[model samples]
Target: MNSEEEFFDAETGLESDDSCEVSFKDATQENGVWERRKKLPAEMISRNNFSVWNILKKCIGMELSKIAMPVVFNEPLSFLQRISEYMEHTHLIHKACSLSDSIDRMQVVAAFAVSAVASQWERTGKPFNPLLGETYELTREDEGYRLISEQVSHHPPISAFHAESLKKEFEFHGSIYPKLKFWGKSVEAEPKGTMTLELLKHKEAYTWTNPMCCVHNIILGKLWIEQYGTVEIVNHRTGDKCVLNFKPCGMFGKELHKVEGHIQDKSKKKRRVMYGKWTECMYSVDPKVYEAYKKSEKKSGGESKKLRQERSCEAEEADEMPEVQETVTVIPGSALLWRITSRPAHSAQMYNFTSFAITLNELEPGMERLLSPTDCRLRPDIRAMESGDIDLASSEKERLEEKQRAARRERSKDEEEWSTRWFQMGTNPHTGAEDWLYTGGYFDRNFTDCPNIY
Candidate 1:
């Protein structure tokens, strides 16, 4: 068994794929996002004592699931930021609204589904739990999209979020409750919920489930994350569906980032195949073209007309591609691939985040002016973390937690409970479960008429 600090500051250094003799300090600062830390936070270090290690070993071996870890290592951002990470790639879903054919829409939705996992790769830091009724909203002026998320329940830790692009006629809404399990060297977090997205123009609705996320090497090695399981997105009205299976990495680290799946009609046997390494890109090809591509792994001479046609369809539609990266445009053909875009820089390099991952916690420019005092974006502790003042961040975090405790005490004494602002508790007709539902409507409601309650 390894000591608590064995991987943190070992004199011999930790093993890594890279040849350079990188210390934990140097490795974490590799991305140049934030300066190297002198040591781990005092709380995290103190919690790593012998008693904590013994408890972790026994509890994890027993597979005592649904257990919560201590909050010492939590990031300064709120859980609302974590929920909004799904919307960072909303442009993909919005594009589905413009496609007339169900096949094209399925492809866009599959891309949307796959993009959600991009932010979780290599990310191990937990976000702070949002206070009851705390809210967050992000409005993209250029994209004409708005996202609103709120902490609707505190006891079971549920968050509800809604996003829409009125111009694109696309909307997404869902609630998430993460089920956590500790396993000695790793933690498994599976979101207990379903999400639905709708395209108003086509009157199409798509629903999908989330996969399990595993945080690896918490005690003996470098910390990172992996997500595995099949995520199926179904278009209820069109009967078109895409089943994406996220491949888990092996013990020796083989097959890292590989994913394969297909899109097919509900009744038809024919399918369009898609496969690729998710960390880089995902490519789609017709079944026949895919078989041919598989056979011609080394030969470049064999190209099909169907592949050329698919390529032309994707390339000709410049409107479907996001303008985040210039390298997004690829040669049209049977191998149509969507590469992950670049993300904003992080404070440390430990998390190998994709381009949009950094924006997950970002309160977009000028958003403070529109935010209410109670909004998570206005939290002092989170702001301190964002600015790299870890000490101040820790102090502010303690202060906020104390404040929350006091508020809860007062509320309990007064027999009062917090309620959500932008969302309402409703029963899900399909699942028969009570969940938070967004009340804002695209065509029926006006934003100007909505109150600024945050």
Candidate 2:
């Protein structure tokens, strides 16, 4: 089942890696990655004519069911209004398949080609893609964000590093990122650089990767937070706005990701006493205690045992405590920008991104939009050994061979199943008669007894 133990022809695959990039400007073809852009009738808009803004307006009532939102929206556009818009863009995606002209197909397909080029627009608004169940929340801080940082010791968790490196590789070789208007103005800059392999040996891979969408990173003094934090709104998950009064603390909960503030805790409730962390983490500490430690550290002398005991019980550890987070309000425009990718390479293997660009003037009144979201951040991961390939060990090579054999067998079995059905059943009444038999019927009807059928 897990063929990771098998050896991969890294050199052959990486060195001879035939990868191409296209853009809305120029496109080429692959195994149907891009199809012709059909000449639609007078009243309709081609998918290309739809900008990010117009598309969002279109998804208002379309039923997504269980689609992968992140893959479709490369970045998170979390707002309901935006989600509805993007959905409309996809409504006509089937048009690409309908076209018959080569140029039209190229134009359609070219829209999907990645040109070592990237564009970034930094806005602190929840940019969510319903297609992919990934979200980005921009907040002042992400204290218990799974992990804030890591070190590379003897064999450190190279987890975050790999994904970051992939992003760098793409930036080095990809397209020029332009500045976003609302994000500010752009300064002159150099075009992106080219990437080439250079280094090393044994490789360890993980089946799971970073979340479908990237979360925003927090800095102590930065004015805007990108992906996760607290915010105001109807809890999209449960639809509760935290307006009901419960026990003391009058029904409080966490903040909305991307937007800042506890979406549930309103300033109007009957002066409810609130203290503690937003999450009911088993080992959560009170924020009061956390502050006490800082206070104690600044004191002139050593702490007494009684004082130490008191310090341990302080509620500084929990931020939700009314004392620490006094202004429980969200200053909108602080959410992550999740972009939508029209067509995904593989439905299951989808990629979505949340991005931000850090600069001195970004949050300033007269902002500089120079650092586009793609420039400041993008989760493009291209993995290949710098030296081209790693040699496979004997066991690994054998394992690879075994895996290939198993795959071949499975494919053959599928072919056999299809072949058997072809000879047993017959054709369609809707279309002209054909030789192929439709196998879908056997599962539902008793064909042996039915006298009248299509």
Candidate 3:
């Protein structure tokens, strides 16, 4: 098989053998009415004919967002819709909100943070960048939450989102400006933004930033992705903290998908040790057990190193990669913190989207009448792509981009500033950093002042 075909086979695999037993429910409430689509109109088009290296050859070491990528490289969803995926595991936030122990609350919050990125696994396709003034709203009465997101800036491409529970239990909001760079063999995304979650019941606020994610082997060999960095989540009210280390895939791939961390109390005393694979599940155990496990692991590593030295020549010549352990080896007393929700049976053919994600772009009959003029659901390009019209999608995407550019030039000539509708740039009360705070009034359904970006 060709490299691209081989990559697809490795990435998507076969249709699930248990498809017959899998639930295909797409039930989500809208306006107290239940209706949703379980699948996109068509399966994702194959990438076998495209050569990424040809497009990225001269763009190495540059910010990728500045380059114009083809629509084929993108899934049907916009970046605003992608941001909404963060809410898929909102139950973790509710769990954290209900806990009385500060340390216990911190553990659940940490799991929620990790779970936020779990949807990206094997999802190599990018989301379409939102036009300036574009917006997306997701309301799930069943989940007791509603989210509103907007493309606040276009030049640096900032996307700001706010989500709150109907019962006023918690508030989650953030403004992200990811810096994407192409490094010849890989593409790296540094999510440069602060994410804040507030538990209204406890009056506690937590803040943290996402880790750097890298897609490797872009030019050759099998493609893979890894997240690597230190993420520090702090509770402002309780002075508690959780530090997680997303390990990079080393030469032997032994550390692939591993996440390890600890939760500390106000006094800097370690309260619990957490470890797991971010792709599957997370577990928290007593600090003493973690330390004993580490000691035993270190001794085993010492023995492996000696054996490696004896066969150093053979190892250097070996082309095979080590098999990654799929499941986390839980200690006897470890408590389950969080586990990923399974994707739909058709996920492999449908952009690798989770069940929650499959509903993000579903535009039910008459739904557009309720959305703002600038909502992403009205974007013709995305709609065309979703309907499996590749040529129309490509043409519409180009036209929309040109329209955006023309509008920018017109505003520049008139010396006018673009005004955001739902969110405004302001100082975050908790972090004291400049952020896009939701100005409310979005749910009031006044579309008179909304932009005509679509």
Candidate 4:
């Protein structure tokens, strides 16, 4: 099938059932990979050129910000929803929580944190700025996890999110404040914030901060993004921490996506070393005592040929396929050496997104009853964009924006301040900053008025 068929199925519509899940692989099947399509419109390309040239002339030695860019350079999702991108590898987190070793859990958490930056690999298109009080929630029944995010502030643009996994006894909450800068040729977004994760079973709490985001090749070449800086994950309970340094791309294309870090004990003694590419997999390896471990399987070579018929009869009795074969390799060794699976390469890119990028803003299948009236899922314009109706999306976006402006004007007349429904204000002990905490009893507290079985 072609690209059009890969994105939409004529029989089942956009929402594919299990039988007809849309695959974005090339039809020829020679190379099973995701086919890249043109991401920008011709008009937008020309508009970007003009905008870049004008900005370069005006800001000769100054840094630029979001105010310098045109709205056309934006994706259809809101920034508040973008925070959910961290959940793409929830399977890893679940597996980690199930493990018994603390070091094993730390490795998995490190992998999850590093892999979260992979979503920014392609072009750096801005997501829409969420209006004040806009909310989004994600519920994964199979994973036994739920997450809720809200936009708390509009002027300085703050967002907060909370996620919990009751089965794993894991809970996390955090806030993000993206500080954007424009340097004529590229833009930098520093997501300054702190996240706290709790393992209730272990009574352990971990905190970490994000790295700096840089978008390059915006002026004269193909645009792409890179994240540079250090990510430090610290266990407040045990004083163990992991520090990862994301190396920036060099000038002549050297070591573009390389990252190396080490896990340290309370006294800063190195324990396990990590090395990998952000776009690929991260591995924990200790080179000081490096040894390869491989498992072997043995089959009886003296078995009689007549016994094959008997085995087939037994297989038939068990409803097993005679032609199919199963091979299990169990390699039991040190748990430090393992790879974190990156996003699937064959997965389709909607508007030049990584495979897991769109999953962040995905609406739960039956969450309509649990959503508030101001939820992002109810926004008609964004929904239009999701369905590939660009014209309708643009019109609806303009209409909604104008309506928002009118509402703001009315609020100004009444001297009213926008208030969030689910989140309450609290102080962050680490930073002493007023933070928004989720008080909606989203996970444990009863929702007596909720019509949905959430």
Candidate 5:
């Protein structure tokens, strides 16, 4: 059978009444307990005057963290706050913990991993590089989780975060040191770190690293982002593993935003095949059905080759490549695992932020009194930027950076080492790699030893 006939068969199967039902509490609901702003105080300004190529031409092949950037390219949030967005899909973790079957639990865990990156769909603005000794804390009693993030390193720019359920059912923590490089028309970021999730009730621990992300058309056309690499998630206690491959966009753009992988048991037997687009949703199907579809697709390869050749010819005649369809075509008998939460209506005017990201920098009434002085909420530059004062934000950013430099010089002159208040350098027990671990005590609210970096 041809590929078109196979697709028709799949569509017919999708209409069957026996499709599986996916259930979970909505992650976007706040339950009237806490209120968050739906939009930023000011809309994003135009970037026509600024030229990224002019600033980045000389810095190609170097780490972008070392280069000083203007506030015009920033999104009024710190990198620490950006990291906290991982918790937006906290319900997935809760769902994983509730499942009894190991394979079912592994499926939910894989869904959680993909959902973590969905927030980056249209987020192109850079987050403010966190200052040394800077910190961010988020307490969401509504969601039953509280997160604390801290900047532990300055030279290499490492951000460490730890989140735990209020009921102590699970813990999620990781330390990321992103190495960003400019390659003429694109900037690629290698997220170097291991993320671990511990389900205390099940005594199961899962560890995985994020895939590499790249922003294309930096010097020419519309800026687009893609994540492409292999992410291997391992369950230390059960020996189950999920291997996911984020496919790069091909010449024909047929594989854009595609992710495919399989789950294997301890004996290396493939149990389930998963396929979907990261931007929209993820689904899992039986290995038998997945194999059958691949065979049919291979049999129709002749037509695909002809189409690719035609597209290549058209590309040489046009200034831009043809637009690819953005939706995922799921196979029949696949169970839905996850879907992205929709953004707010005003998201486009607010740096393309999601509903959760719009509230990351909000300072509620009397909230400042309860926070540490070194918190990112108190950073003058970010505050100014969020309020639409571009001039003040730019000047404040320069002043704070100079102050940090002066402090570093003083410490060097006095032969002193910078001390991190919330986290310490340690080794990850599961991965056996050097990492920054959370040292419990940020919630105690005692700020005596915290540095005054702001």
Candidate 6:
């Protein structure tokens, strides 16, 4: 058999034996948005170069074509309908709900992403559509009521894939190899999440109405792992340091990073050394600790001799008989697993987002205390200078305001462009509900009638 035959059995149009039922739920919130006003320092104000609303344009929903940077589509309804019909797991929902309530440092980071996105809408009258609708409390915003769309689109528990991705990225980013392993997507494993955060002493802790844990540079994914998932972070530095407190999204743990202590000057140059150095060091695990972690995989057959013998023989024969191996391979797909692509419905650059970047911003006395003298905060905010200090500050301030107005204008233009495309699809907001009014990044830049996952 060839790749076509093994991965896609076009002849039978049959799906794999391993499949799960998916469902969606509206998060248990009335409006799926937080109600509040953010107050910035009188002198220093911060604005976004990129709107959080834009992140929605990029990631409003998931699509099958997202696998390729440039995607192709076939069987529109069959494809998306299948994507919507993910596996139904009560345990997953429970865990998701549980995780969404975590208040850990990592959880705060996720919340900040939501808050940041929501802020953009409030600031610019744009919309913040959510994959999962959740709320801090009862409140309404100017744009409209945000919905959590608790429609849990279930697929295979992607923890192993996620962990593997993280491991690979961590090694690459840290330049140190740990015991990285990518667990194949597993059916038996329940997908759940928790958070652990170690705030370096020098990093700024933004004190909002609710203190939030700010994580810079990385895409802060859903808090508590898609509402009920697992994220483990082992702090090899600070034995016990809790630097943040915020609204509960789920349960979390705390530890400090090892690089914080070696700093002499609390300057950007010094912090840079620590951040770049230790994150690369591979934290070792004790033999006992490593063994205990294998419990999750213990049930998949307990490493039986018979299984090993069969696997060894199969490998031996595979070298000599390629066709036999091909015949034995399982085709992985679903009758529902088709693809969807489209012309550019949104702005060209706004449609496809590589990922969401979130950071906490402090209002007053901004950078003065953001990087504490004792804290070894990495990546201290770099303020670009335009001229001599005073003249530069005044000119830059005016320039920032002008850029903001221009951004608002650009957003309006993008909306108009998208609206033209939406009308082309014959979708009417005022019209009564229709059967399949699925519009997302899929029809936008996601598919672009090209590859996916760019």
Top candidate (TM-score)? 5
Question: 1-454 in candidate 5: lDDT tens per residue?
Answer: 1101110011101121212211111223354433456677899866778999889999889889899887898889999999998887787798888899988889889988887887887788889999999999976655567789999999999999999987788999999999999988788999899899998899999999988998877777677788889999999999999999998777766666788999999999999998888888889989999999889888987456777655541232222333556677778889988877777777888988877788788776566677888889899999899888999999999999999999999999999999999999999888888989999987777888989898
Q: What range of 10 consecutive residues in model 1 has the weakest lDDT sum?
A: 1-10
Q: Go through the candidates in order and give each one's C-alpha lDDT.
A: 0.62, 0.20, 0.83, 0.61, 0.82, 0.19
lDDT of 6 by residue, 127-180 (tens): 111111111100011111111111111121111000001111110000000111
Write model 2 residue lDDT over 150-255, tens digit each, in one string: 1111011010011012111110001111111121111111211111111111111101000011112111111221121121112122222312111112112122
What TM-score does model 4 achieve against the real structure? 0.72
Candidate scoring better on lDDT of 1 and 4:
1
Error (Å) of candidate 6 at residue 369 is 59
TM-score-better candidate, 1 vs 2: 1
Candidate 5 wrongly placed segments (more than 4 Å)? 1-34, 300-303, 309-322
**Tens digit per residue, CA lDDT, model 4, 107-164:** 7778778866766666466787776677777654434566788778766778889888
What TM-score does candidate 3 get on C-alpha atoms? Answer: 0.89
In candidate 1, list every pair of residues with a backbone clash: 34-347, 311-333, 342-355, 343-355
What TM-score would each prediction reach against the true structure? 0.72, 0.16, 0.89, 0.72, 0.90, 0.17
Expressed as tens digits, the lDDT of each residue in 1-454 for candidate 1 is 1111111121333333323212212233334442223322222222244233444765664433333334446654587877777765666765677678888888878877777777665566777777767777655433446677877777778888888773658888889887676776677888878888888888888888887787766665456666788888888887888888887765323345667888889896557887765555677778887676667764775547564444331222121211112222222354553556554344254234343334444453554445555567677777666566666777877777677668779889999876566789898644466767887642222334332322
Measured with C-alpha atoms, the lDDT of residue 15 in candidate 3 is 38
Please give the distance, in angstroms, between residue 379's alpha carbon in candidate 6 and its true position after superposition.
52
Please say which candidate is ahead in lDDT: 5 or 6: 5
Judged by whole-model lDDT over C-alpha atoms, candidate 6 comes out at 0.19
